[model samples]
Target: MKQKVIVQLVDTLDLGGTERMSVNLANTFQEQGWESHLVVSRQSGGLQNYLNPEVQVHFLEKKSFKDLKAFWRLSKLTRKIKPDYIHAHSTSIYWAVLLKMLVGSFKLIWHDHFGLSDQLEENKRSEMVILSKWIDRFIVVNHKLLDYWQKLLPYRKNSIVYLSNFPYLKLNESIQKLPQFTFLNLANYRPQKDQLTLIESCKILDNEGFDFRVLLVGQQVDSNWETQIKQKISEYSLQEKVRVNGPSEDVTSLLAEVHVGVLSSESEGLPVSLLEYGLAKLPVICTDVGNCAEVLKSGELGQLVKVKDPKLLAEAMKHSINNYEEEVGKAQQLNQYVLEEYGALKFFESYQKLVGAVK
Candidate 1:
């Protein structure tokens, strides 16, 4: 049989778990001998640098979903590639929905990479509910999302499934070294990330004379959110302890020096950062939301704290420090678990089987 061609569609090549997952799957499939292609609906960003050279990239530079010119452009590309499946991630599903209508050849696989699965009702997209019926299949990054989408598209219950977000291993070491016990957060500045809670935790740690340092590493997506986080950092005089910065290509190397990995997001859907932390063998302190408790295996692998609770987060941070050796042991356990459970090969095999059965 001929090699199957798979195409991944996403809104951007930005630094987020969803975008990283798109790139991850594309790279994995291509490395596994499939003709994998990646399609970016709008502008491309730094994450594009991580893609495998074997994979082809197409940029639509779409102004809006209604941009007919871009739609036609994508339609033409679809005819040329005639892919067996178009796996669209997050917002890119909108375009995929349109493509399915226009071309009517490829299977539409819409992956729900929504972060606010904890608050799905409040943030429901009417357009998605209306258009979801067009999706040939659905993939969710977390179990909560699988539940949400199943309820929304009850007719497609059998078609929806949950898959874990695999890690994007950072191989190179960071150029600069942080303090021995510095905390690292690999998330973009978004409201859902709730960087404020982390700032408050930093303040609590500082006031309690805990002597800690936090390195915020990820893309600066929301200028407003960035301003708010930095304003809080400045107002609290946390300039010394909390270092809010932008994306770094050196995360794998940076993991070498950081004492722990942390996420304070009010909502998340199996963040890839946590998987990277586990793969890097770093102790974790994350807010209990989405599949985090499941990913960390209910504190068996890493520590899980209540969401939006700075005091509790601060306490967890303190505990990690006070029992550094124990946390390290847990980190080692997490490393083995991530390797066994969230390896890229497993994801590729699962997706290959799914695609093979789709027809």
Candidate 2:
């Protein structure tokens, strides 16, 4: 049997959920005895370090939306690689569509990591519809997205699939003890991430004399947003209670020190952070957004609160900490469920079957 060749395409290797998934898929493909290559249409960032050394990495260094040089370079590379399939993550589908037009033989699969769900604008939907004809398959992260796209392109229902994002960490249990009751929010500084709401919740915890700290970890995607978060921390006198740490590659080590994991995003497409939290076996407290409720089994496995409500978030956080033993036991059960349902082995197996059926 011939080994399948796959090229995973993405805008960059930034510390975002989509970027991490692209890297994870590429690595998994290589590990599963496939010819795996990763191409970054734009420049690379910190997440590049996490990529498997066996997978080839290419950077086009795209300077603008219409950089003909970058386009030519990607086209040339695609021609040389001659992959059996080009798996495009997020907006990289635009470039993959162009490459398909130029090359004409390899399959093009678009992995939709669109965070807005049903809130997508008219122009974006129109653009996606126009491009849907060229795509051979559409891989969605959740059923909601699958349903939305299925209804949008009724004729293309057979081509769309719902593939959950799997946990990609290799954890080593640490014997070291954590200093304080710590909660981690593992998302980049963005408006949609709603870290400000997390800060407000921290203020509430502090006012009630809770001895805990919340750590915000990820790249500062927006400098203005980071400044606003800092201002809120200062205004609320939460300098000690809240800490904003930039992106770190050592997530497993960080996970070992935290007591709880939290995601306060306003929107999501089945957040990878939630999976990481499960993998780390930390009790999760997340806002009711995206597929979070589904991932938490409607709060049976974790705690879910209303978005933008600091009081509710604080109350949930307090409840989780107060019932740490019981909550952690439930989190441990969730960890096993995640490993069974979204493990790397299962993800790779599904992709193999999907790609086999593409032709």
Candidate 3:
């Protein structure tokens, strides 16, 4: 029998990229003849829909973040599972390290999905530093993060691996037939996501008499960020041009319908949204953040505008629309690039190497 693989996440219900990717990876493991288990601190999010019957999910009712009782519960659970590998995503790695120390058996792999803006905060940096020594491999989404992890945790010299969070999006036929002039941005409302910049840029386009509709798709992660975005839209009277749609599982379908995909994030870590855009053959406009420009091949696949610069962003958006056919051809070429580089088979191959190195 193949060894069991365990994925540990802080919360199971959240529909964030990290959680969704965790579910994807777990499902992949199952198809490869490995038993998959998802262990989470809480049961409270949108993850239920993504869970496979083959993958068992355990939600431990922890006392609190600082409570020793929670630690004990986690440790006990880990001991019972005796997983071949314990793959941790985000801040959960910190606790996974402690649990590993207590159980002292399963191999540890740390997958990073958080963006550059997340690393700027002192508290998060300190936490990464504290947890650096305990993990076996540091899986980053891009070279920038790999460098950051190396500097922060230099002892793990050969432990870094680049694993982009690109998923296999099965496009729905219905959405593929939607009308053009629809642009999509899939990100939870957050300052770092910079939806305000996108809206402002859209306002510029509207003034220029561009024929387009903007679809902002994501849930309100931060209430203030959501409120600020709505206010900006109201201020610009962009209600006619822009529509804010809440988070939807049909991202590929949405991408299929749109002519252009835009992300004006102040920071990111190889956003899956861009990858989804590429797969759907939609021309993309993204700010130069994380690995977006790199994936876009510095405007070969899509245009990269400066973050928060509405004028540049507006110009790029218009240029993309003006050169629609040519840009989409480039997008298709980029789609092939992603299929070769970030596909599930490639990701699994990289996973094997990391697992071998640690094992």
Candidate 4:
């Protein structure tokens, strides 16, 4: 039997959830005995180092949306690779669809990581409708998106699958713990991430005499957003309480230094950061957004607060601190759930089935 070939398509490896997922999938596919290749349609970024050594990576260095040269390069590369399947992540689906039209027959799967969920714009929906005929399959991170897409493409219901995001951590049992009530918010600086809300929560906590620190780890993708966050941190006198670090290659190492994990995003899909927190066995406090409640098992596994509510977020943080032992136990339970349900073997099996059914 011939080994299967899969090429993962992504815009960049920019140290975000979708970028990390693309890298994880490529690595997982290679581990599952497939000839895995990763194609970056644009420039590379910090997360590129996470790609498995066995996986081949190609970069098109796309200049802009109208970079036809990059598209031509991708088509040529696809022809050379002759992959059994081309799994496109998010906006990269456009490139893959165009490649199929220009080149030849190859299974194209679109992995939707859209953060807006049901609130996706009409223009995007119209575009999807036009591309629906060319896309062979669809993979969504949450059931809400699955339902949304199912309604959008009633005729293609059979092609859509809902798969949960899994952790991509390399576990270490001997990590040294930091000596503080450290909270981690692992999200890029964006309007949707709502870092300002988290900062406000921290201010409330500080006023109530809670001596804790927050580590914001992700790319400063938007300069204006970064400026606003820094300004808020300064205004709240949270310079000592909050540290805005750019993306790190050593996420596991960073997780070791924190006692609690947090996600105060205004919106999300099934965030991989939450999974990483579980894998690290860190007690979590996240806003009730996207599939977070589902992942946290409706607050059974972790603490869930309402979005943009500083008082509620502060109270949750206080609760987690006061009930540290109990929260640790819950964290352990979440870790076990992630390992059992989202383990590499199970993920690979589901992916194999999805790919096999594509034809």
Candidate 5:
């Protein structure tokens, strides 16, 4: 009888996987006949274009980490909406925690979309542990994250859940490849993504007379890391072989044009791009990290390589193109997995149940 309201909080609307997931969740909530509100603490970016117009968007333009004025505005908005759950994504957990402390209402759910699964201890932060007490529910994108946090916070272990990410795109039954055999790595420019290694692999392909182009596309998070990527590209003479660009609002068209999808990340947690690749039915070759092996079904669905190994990555890329038809079959199989396991409807339903059980 009553409409449900939810506010998805994010530090920014950057084109990263976590930010995309935040927008996707908000849109899904609105489409499912719920009052969805997306609150951006700092600023909004290209990802905002992907959001449904009906979903309410709020911006704080937060200036610093400890900007009390921004938090004060956020507190006002939270009181106005009185969201059933303030689903905070990534570092925005701090904002949600502060909101609960300030207003003392609404269910607080923290979606831990941490990318690094290999070295959990190194990634741990004191601030996160201090704020964990306020979290009503903890949702992890991968099992590794779930396990790590559960052990660290054993008291709330039962409340932590392992929920895979669901992409915004639907499965494409009829897939198309570009005439030029292009490769697309749809990840933000960061040290964790290891785009430099992908560039090195492209150099190897170019040296071996492979007529292919690689597109490095995502939001430029770290300018210094991006500088390293460009320097590596120039160092390896892959100027024409690789094209670097920022986030694209039209990823569906890009997916349709790319023959192969790749991820060279050293760490990830059910990468949204990998799910999109399956939806697009593009053969994948990614470094074996995080839940990638789970997504690929232990290399049955696509190719997997060790982290940061350019030679292995290069060999896998060569094998993929050389065995194009076979790889495409694997791509189709992966599509089935993604559609069945990572549908937005299923994600929304799960969250609905989880929200009710929150402490």
Candidate 6:
């Protein structure tokens, strides 16, 4: 019988990048003859149908994010499943280690999707110092965090793997032109994503008589922040220029019809939206934060400006529109590079190596 691997996450149905990547990785394992299953803390997100039909999903319906009872339940489930490996994505690492210690069978592997500095809250850094020792392997999404881990946690240098999230959608040969007035930002409305910057930039464009439209995708993690942004848009009389479209599974198709892709995040691991934009052949303008600068090859593929600089962002957008041919060339080059580097085959190989090393 094939060895079993259990992938654990806080939610299986959230349309966020990490959640989607977890589903993709779990599905890939099953294709390679491993018995793969997903254990979600809750079932409220919209991602259940996205899992492979063959793979099973278990929901704990934890009472809350801080429910200690859920951790006990997870520990029991881990013992019952007796998986050959336990791959924990995102915040589940906190419990994955303890569960493995309790069950004493599964090997623990943790994937870190955020930047090193953002790993824990400022007040909880002391706690992170304590927990870092329990992780068997640390899968990082970029070189910056890989370097940070190597310098501060030298003993773990050998266990740090640099693999990025893979693109989930494939492109069509019949390329379609984007609508004349549409631009897009695909990220949750949170402080980390810096939607205020995008809103300010759109206001600048509006004042300059640019006839452009904006689509803000992803869930609003902060309702107050969303309301603030809406008020700003109204104050600037930009209702015709901007619309918050909530979360979307149709982002790939939407990107195919958008003139430009924008990411104004204050930080990121490796944005899956940027990869999707490349696959859709849409030009991009993003902030020089997290691994975004590295992914764009230090501004070779797309325009990268400082975060929260509305004027600079607006200027970059104008430059992209005015120099259409150059922007298209950059898009083509980035599309080629992203496909070659982050294809699903490569992702599968990385996981295979991780599992094989432990075996």
lDDT of candidate model 1 versus the reference:
0.87
Give per-model TM-scores.
0.95, 0.97, 0.92, 0.97, 0.96, 0.90
lDDT of 3 at 319: 87
**Model 5 regions more than 4 Å off:** 170-176
lDDT of candidate 5 vs native?
Answer: 0.89
Error of 4 at 180 (Å): 1.6
Model 6 misplaced regions, further than 4 Å: 1-4, 65-69, 115-124, 171-178
The list of candidate 2 runs beyond 4 A from truth reads 121-124
lDDT of 4 at 264: 93
lDDT of 6: 0.77
lDDT of 4 by residue, 1-359 (tens): 89999898999989999999988888898888899999998879988888889999999999987898998888888889898899999988887888888875689899999987736653256688889888998999988788888988899999999988877878666888778889999999888899999999999999989988899999987889999999999998999999999999888788887899999988888999999999999999999988999878999999999988999999999998899999999999999988998777787899888888876
lDDT of candidate 2 over 102-178, digit per residue (tens): 89789999999988763655325667889987999999998778888888899999899999998788877864637
Tell me the tens digit of each residue's lDDT in model 3 across 282-316. Answer: 78889998888789888877888988898999998
- The TM-score of candidate 2 is 0.97
Question: What are the Cα lDDT values of the candidates?
Answer: 0.87, 0.89, 0.79, 0.89, 0.89, 0.77
Worst 10 residues of 3 by lDDT: 117-126
Q: In terms of TM-score, which candidate is stronger, 2 or 3?
A: 2
Question: What tens-digit string does per-residue lDDT give for candidate 6 at 179-247?
Answer: 665778988877888888888998888888887788898886789888888888888888888998788
Assess candidate 5 and give its TM-score to the true structure. Answer: 0.96
